[model samples]
Target chain A: MIIAEQKPIQEIKAMIASYQKILVVGCGTCVTVCMAGGEKEVGIIATSLRMALRLDGKKPEITEDCIQRQCEWEFVDALKDRISKVDAILSSACGVGVQALAERFPDKPVYPALNTTFMGMPEKHGLWIETCRGCGSCELGRFGGICPIARCSKGLLNGPCGGSQDGKCEVSKEMDCGWQLIYGRLKTLNQLDQVEEILPPKDWSTDRDKGQRRILREDVYYEQTV
Target chain B: MAEFEPKLIAFCCINCPSSSVTVCESMGMSIPTNVEVVRVPCTGRVDILHLLKAIESGADGVYVAGCSDGNCQFTDGNVKANRRIERVKKLLDEIGVGGQRVEMYRMSAAMGPRFAEVAREMTERVRGLGPSPLRR
Candidate 1:
């Protein structure tokens, strides 16, 4: 899921400072799962903003709302009525959600309340770590189910780098070496032979190196009118 | 000039801290009128939002009273509460609200006198810091 963390209260305040009445919107999906930009978080950030703004002596009117999935057209479209009432929008969703709202409502100024961090999952309660880079390629079957491209300090495809020490990455002791994790997993699975085969350089075109990747499924589209 | 009486909110855990407050009341130990005691099933129930909301809604200071370390009925409820209290304190400091405005106290159900002591302590602390700038 797309992980995000709410921007500092001061940053958020500045984003909508010019607008008197603002609506704080939350996404009910990934950001909610990370406990950053969920419905409950919306209430918290909204209340904080109200108090923060009051301290500035700007008694701006602020309101809160959360959509089912901010990335979807239908869910964000439902906010049309609410959007009409507010001067601007402070979106507490991921970057994608923020863009979706901005694209949907070209007239209103939309600002992000969160810094969309990464494609990740919670390692434990209240702790989220990046797990995928969404590199637009899947070779997990060859690397024991972990993506070195996302987890390694250097997206090494062949094996661990010299920086790997005792299964920990040189970048940070707290971070486990991604290639080490893969090596361990393959050893346990008796598939260490997979590492002997050196993988060719990944096709840069398949990744974000190519501008704005998209998938147009002709099968999913409606038939042309007669 | 009038004396600044800080408006305070205390989220008390029912098992120990609340009982201690009840005992204090039964013994005619007067709690500071400035403090409002809010009973909760556990200190862990108190979230960052709850503490922030208290300050936003005119509380000059806020606190949580829970069981002593390793003594929560739910085993780790008070620990969880401490983490949230610390987080709120950091957030308050970041927001220029003064983290000293919020605190956490630990005591058992039998510590009746201690409950009143904590109430007085928090009241004085808030008084020292002056009323919250964000107080409504």
Candidate 2:
């Protein structure tokens, strides 16, 4: 899932300072699961903004609303009535959702209230760790289900680097060397011989090297002959 | 200008502070008139939104009173509430509202006097801070 964190209130306040009437939108999907932007968070942000503005002697009209998924047009369409009532929008969704809303309503000013951090899952309560870089590639089968691209400090493809010490990465003592983990997993599975064959360089073009990428599934695409 | 009597709100866990409130009342002790006690199943149920809404709705100060640390009826409820309180405090400070307005306290159901003491302490602290700036 996409994980994000709410931006500092000061920064959000500054962004909407010029607008007296504002709508705070929350996404009920990824951001909701991460506890950054959701229905509950929408109320919190709105109330905090109101209190802050009131303290500044500003009589701002702030409204709170949340949709099932901000990235979907149908879900975002539910907010049309509320969107029309406000001068600006403070989206507490990921960057994609914010952009979707902006594209849907080009006339209104849309501002992001969260910094989209990474594609990851919660390790524990209130703790999210990055797991995937979305490099447009999948090679987990070759590395004992661990992707070096995302976990390795240097994104090394083969065995552990010289910097790896006591199974810990050179980047930080707390960070486990990704290759070391791969080695350990492979050893447990009696597949340590797999590491002897050096792997080829990754295909960079499949990633950001080719600019924005998209998947076109002809099977899923529908067309009307009429 | 008239003396400011800060409106304070306390989110007390039903298992502990609520019992403490009853015990305090039985002992002929009463909470301040300006302070309102809201009972919840657990301190963990007290979302940040609730705290912000209370302040926005004219609460000069707000605090969560739950079971002492490990004694939470729901096990880590108080601990979770403590983290949320800290987050809310940082948010309040960032929004120009002093973080001191919000706080968290823990005590067992047997401590009736401690409950009253917290009320007095919070009321006195808020009184010194003055009415909530958001108050109309």
Candidate 3:
């Protein structure tokens, strides 16, 4: 899932300082599971901002709302009534959701309250670790389910670098060497031979010339389905 | 100007902190009138939002009184509550609300006098800081 963390309160404060009536929006899908932007988080941010603004002697009207999926139009449309009333929006969702709000509500100024960090899963409760870079490629099959591009510090495809020490990456002591994990997993699966064959370079092209990647499924369009 | 009377909120774990408050009162110890006690099953139940709400609702000071470290009935409830308090404190400080307004205390049921002492200490600290900026 897409992982993110709330931006510092001061930065967020500065972004919405000009707006008196503000709406804080949270997304429920990815950010919810990752504990960055969710319904509960929405309450926390709104209440904190409310108190913070009051501390500055600003009498601002703050509202809190969350949708099932901020990336989708239908869920975002549920906030139309509330959006119309607010002078600005403080989006606690990921960047995608923030852009969606910006595109949908062209009139109101929408600001992001979170830094969309990476695609990851919870390493443990309250601890999220980045797992994927979304490099527009998937080669987990060759590495025994661990993508060197994402897990390796240098994104080394062939094997572990000399910097790997005691199964940990030299980039950070906390990071596990991606190739080490791959080798261990393959050994356990009795497929260590997979590492001997060097893999080819990844196809990095995802239509970079177009500026943004997109997917359009003509078969899944509503008119055709209906 | 009249003397500033700080409004305080205490989240006491039902197991120990709550009992300590009760024991303290039974022993004729007086808790500050400005401090309100809220009983919860455990300090771990005290969330970041709970602490923030206390401040947003004009609490000059907020604290969670839980079981002493390593003595929690739930094993680690107090530990979790402590982390939450620290996070809230940092967040409050970042927003210029003064994190000193929030605190965490460790006490068992038999520590009746200690509960009152913590209350006085917290009340005095908040009083020193004056009324919360968000106070209506």
Which regions in candidate 2 have their CA more than 4 angstroms from the true location?
A222-226
DockQ ranking, best first: 3, 2, 1
Worst 10 contiguous positions by lDDT, candidate 3 chain A: A217-226
- Top candidate by DockQ: 3
Better lDDT candidate (1, 2): 1
lDDT of each: 0.91, 0.89, 0.89
lDDT tens digits, residue span B1-136, model 2: 7888888899999998889999999999988888899999999999988888887777899999999868987889999999999989998888877889999999989889899999999999988887776774
Off by over 4 Å in 3: A207-210, A222-226
After the best TM-score superposition of candidate 2, give how far the Cα of residue A108 lies from its true spot, in angstroms.
1.3
RMSD of 1: 1.9
Can you write out model 3's per-residue Cα lDDT over A1-226, one digit (the tens) per residue? 9999998888898999889899999998999998889999989888878877787888789988989999988899899999999999999999999999999999999999999998888888988887787776677877788878888989898887889899999999999999899999999989998888887776778525547888788787675421
lDDT of 1 by residue, B13-73 (tens): 9999988988999999989888899999999899989999999888999999999989998
Clashes of each: 0, 0, 0
If scored against the real structure, what TM-score would every candidate get? 0.97, 0.94, 0.95
lDDT at position B73, candidate 1:
87
RMSD of 2: 2.1
